[model samples]
Target: MRSVAITGTRATGHRPPDEYGAIFSAYLRPFADGHFYIGGAKGIDSLALLWLAGNSAAHLTVVVPGTVLHQPTEAQQAIARTRERIQDVVELGAAELDTPAYHARNRWMVDHASMTIGFPHADEPEGGTWQTLNYTAEQGKPRLIVPV
Candidate 1:
């Protein structure tokens, strides 16, 4: 089966809910039959999880740098709301929630997935979403970039 790793910015305040819903419907719907590995954070992660859970039959895996409790309240609530739909939750169990830990979690997801779909807000060279997309490129995996 096709498997995908999703990466995006945590800041998604600029857009309205309907815009995101439309974006997800167009981009994520094509891959709805595949398994998805999400970051389990705010922004695109939580939004994608919510949309996928409600709209698709894909196997969902929510991965975190730490535990779900350590994530933002919004992310936790998203996970809780979609608990039944999610097939798994992978907690890396990192004590320090730093950039390295997050990168590791991203890499872990990318390593397991056949491709990656990134929704970066801008052309940020140092952004985590960009980093994951770059890493996927380095690993010789396919990537679909969708700027939000």
Candidate 2:
């Protein structure tokens, strides 16, 4: 099956659990039949990785913003477990933690997938989720937005 990239807000305090579950099962599962592309971050990126973990046929590529295990956090450590469980994981390191490089990572994710799913928060324009969505739209790729 074709590959798809998943993107969304990191700060997801407003998202209801049921809503995320429905979004994952309904919007994420079909694309995750085989190889799937996910940026290495929290919230929806991590959630998609978690769901895709159960699908043995699925391959996951986690395009990261910095060096592998570069900016490790508690959440990222948890994601590292899921990453280890997956068949594949791709790390695209940024030279530094600059806005340009971070946005570049998002663009790279868009270029690799024909489809993207984004959960956008109204407040953050420079956020990775919004940036990824915008990049996908600019490329005219199919995109789904889960509103905040």
Candidate 3:
């Protein structure tokens, strides 16, 4: 099966209720048989993970910057429930939630996947999500941007 990486903004301030889950499911449906690669961050990452846990048959690999402990409480709960289904948990030994480490983790996801699915904010043109999308394009990988 192919691998598809998921990346998006960490901010949930403007996300409408249930919108993220709907968008994530729609974007992921095409890759239902593929493995999913995601950084276990809050916001979109956690939302995607929860959606995948309930909706897809795909294998999951959560690539964390440091440890699972660093994840948001809700994400940690979701991971615990879906622990049996996860194929791998890659801890990249990041000392903290620094920009460089997150960027490195994003690159790792983009490099490993056949394509990337992103939830990006058009207004914010220079964040990690945008950088990951740019990297995906630079790598010549297929990318799908779910408009929020």
Best by lDDT: 1
CA lDDT of every candidate? 0.95, 0.73, 0.86
Model 3, 1-148: lDDT tens per residue? 8999999877766978487767776778779789999888877887788788788889999998888998788778878888888889998989978999999999999999999999876577779998899999999999988755
Ranking by TM-score: 1, 3, 2
- TM-score per candidate: 0.98, 0.83, 0.92
Shift of residue 67 alpha carbon in model 3, Å: 1.0
lDDT of 2 by residue, 34-111 (tens): 577776777667766777775445777877788657644734764767857766556666778677876887888789
Q: Pick the candidate with the highest TM-score.
A: 1
Superior by lDDT: candidate 1 or candidate 2: 1
- Candidate 3 global TM-score: 0.92
Cα TM-score of candidate 2: 0.83
Q: CA shift at 148, candidate 1, in angstroms? A: 0.7
TM-score of 1: 0.98
Any residue pairs clashing in model 2, and if so which?
Answer: none
* Higher-lDDT candidate of 1 and 3: 1
Candidate 1 vs. truth: CA RMSD? 0.8
lDDT of 1: 0.95
